[model samples]
Target: MRLFSLTILLAAVTALAGCNFKSVPEPQVSARDAEWLAQVPKAEEDIRYARYLMDDETGETPGTIVVDTKQRFLYYVLPDRKMIRYGVTVGDEAYGWTGTSRVARKAEWPNWNPPAEMKARWPHVHPMQGGPANPLGARALYLYEGNKDTLYRIHGTNEPEKIGLAVSSGCIRMRNIDVIDLYNRVDLNAKVIVR
Candidate 1:
């Protein structure tokens, strides 16, 4: 009887030790987020939008990002006159912007707070928490002119079907996998020229 009681105590102690008392509770996911997640397609990219390494025609220095809205491509200049090109989705004609800006910051799986203009345009728009369903996809490079944020981002998109199209409000959108690759390569405050 004494040995059995000791064995039971040992088992109880082992079970208690395996439990995590300080673990944080998971946040509740909203219905909208669930709906968005359901829409995520497989990560297959179209041949036209596939990443390619090609000659740098923009003549920008190494580590510069050149965005050609007309062709719907973003080029990351490399050393030795080489560039990595990735197809992207640019703003529609009425919402397009062209200027030189710096990547002020970057985020992985970033939470999205719709800009005032965007909110006004779409009354149903709401802030979304970061996750697989988030429209910002896997990464984001925030654009800024000096210290002021232009509210523009080069970010991953959930809608891979929109690549190589002019459809966003004024942001540059890339496939999630492509943006993840770009985010890993680019540094903060890198030069970005959108034309």
Candidate 2:
């Protein structure tokens, strides 16, 4: 009887091992978006997406966006203490601003309007229409404090190579594909915490 039971258990384990489970498919990138992505350099392996386990240390409630500027990571808190983390580029020290805010509004392929200060610094500054080639690569989540626009953004970037650096003026920059993924997962008015 013991030998018969052992044989059945082994068969079950072997069958389970042979079973193939499919994973979720990646989001489809449009032809225009694909062409644009082909132009930008690939991000380093360290900056790639990963699942992180969250604990009480992550004070914010679920669905909050926590931007770790020092670590160059953005965490979108999910249910059951799991988070989807993406590598990001934060603003350089001179242009960096840290505070709590909310996603006031969102836009797809948002236009690039150089602020007056940026234009003053570089007279060549000009607004660029929204498209694959635009600086705001594929999406923009406008951050706001109360009803006022903070003029800072968490948006996709044309430069994928900048994903793990501090180079933006003040906006949090994400890779086009990563930003699009985040754009889909987060809701308008979601809490954003920068640290």
Candidate 3:
């Protein structure tokens, strides 16, 4: 009878010990990614848009890009449940698009071709050549849906002040340097999720 009572006590203690043990939280970001982010110039004079590390449990595989419009953040999922987050400027509610797409094409110093509707709204504006002054500042990743051009882009912006704000026409905008970094890391046909 005493042996049975001792076994019961030992089992209860072991169960309690197991319940108290906690698993270590996985790292959010990597040092190399953070170093790259540090090189990007601040969007504003006193306001810097610093990329961060975060624990991502979203089940997205590495190399996937996820845009959280509400937070003005773009996350690149990394191996081992980590994410490298970047600040982004999202489109306003009226022009915002939320869907999944793939990067169909990429270009450096991409030109700006104002849509016909935009041309009508601003008659003086014309298709601008790719340069520092162009709206597509330094790099452009053309987003496509099933081989069809969506006319939406994830590109750099000359107007760095717009970062972290809802001020784009209908695209994801990043700073020139940051966009260049992203351009180098992302591959053609990379999955992009905008939400």
TM-score of 3: 0.75
- Model 3 residue runs over 4 Å out of place are 1-48
Clashing pairs in 2: none
Positional deviation of residue 110's Cα in model 2 after best superposition, in angstroms = 0.9
Point to the candidate with the largest lDDT.
1
- Per-candidate clashes come to 0, 0, 0
lDDT, candidate 3, equals 0.78
**lDDT per prediction?**
0.84, 0.80, 0.78
Q: How far is candidate 2 from the true structure (C-alpha RMSD, Å)?
A: 9.8
Reference-based lDDT, residue 31, model 1: 72
Pick out the ten consecutive residues of candidate 2 with the lowest summed lDDT.
47-56
Candidate 2, residues 97-183: lDDT per residue as tens digits? 899999989988899998898889889979999876678888899999999999999998877777888999989998787788888
Full candidate order by lDDT, most accurate first:
1, 2, 3
TM-scores for all candidates: the values are 0.79, 0.79, 0.75
Instruction: Give me the runs in candidate 2 sitting further than 4 Å from their true place.
Output: 1-25, 39-57
> What TM-score does candidate 1 get on C-alpha atoms?
0.79
Please give, for residues 48-135, the per-residue lDDT of candidate 3 as tens digits: 2545566774579888889999988888787888876778899999889999999999997778998886788679989888766778
